[model samples]
Target: MSGRRLAELLAATETQTPQGGQAVSFEPLGWVWLKAGSRRRRERTEAGVTRMIETMRVETRADPRLVAGRVLRFDGDDWTVVAVEVDAERPGRVRADLERRP
Candidate 1:
């Protein structure tokens, strides 16, 4: 896809700061595309009881500054990035699995 199309799809702005050992701060990184993935439920045993855990995927451009554990504000909601994967075929794209912040 063309960069223009990609830019148009990237309607959300995200802010993140370099991960330092101490305090956490954020700086705007401009607009980015945010795509939601399908919902998944996994059964897990916790405290001797079965529970269902839910997760979803979120895709965006390949931004070097974005990393796991960063809180992203999108669509008036806060999402925490759990994992990041770069698309080998499309070097400029990236996929991130996000979980809604509680």
Candidate 2:
């Protein structure tokens, strides 16, 4: 797809999921599936950064085909989840930095 097309798609998705979305579980290098209407978790730094920390919700799955990873597929678009850090307290949520893949 063209860069413009991809950008448009992401923008649409962001609007649809303003609260963010859920990221299914997968391995470090495994392919992941991401969809809209998932969930979003947010946090705010009381004094330090003075900005809210937002992240997408992620949940693990027993089946290998359905879990978390650094790569995600959504709406026929592929995105790479970079700087993915798991929440120490919440096992189901992950702080994922998303970037377009290819």
Winning model by lDDT:
1
Residue lDDT tens for model 2, 8-88: 112112223445874444333343333323433455566686554434333332223332333455545455444545557
What CA RMSD would you report for each candidate?
8.3, 14.6
TM-score of 2: 0.31
lDDT of 1 by residue, 1-102 (tens): 112212111223444547634554555555566666675767767689987665667667788767787666655556667799997887788887766523
lDDT (CA) for every model shown?
A: 0.61, 0.39
Local distance difference test, candidate 2: 0.39
Listed per model in order, the count of residue pairs whose N, CA or C atoms clash below 3 Å is 1, 6
List ranges where model 1 is wrong by over 4 Å.
1-29, 41-54
**Model 1 alpha-carbon miss at residue 2, Å:** 21
TM-scores for all candidates? 0.54, 0.31
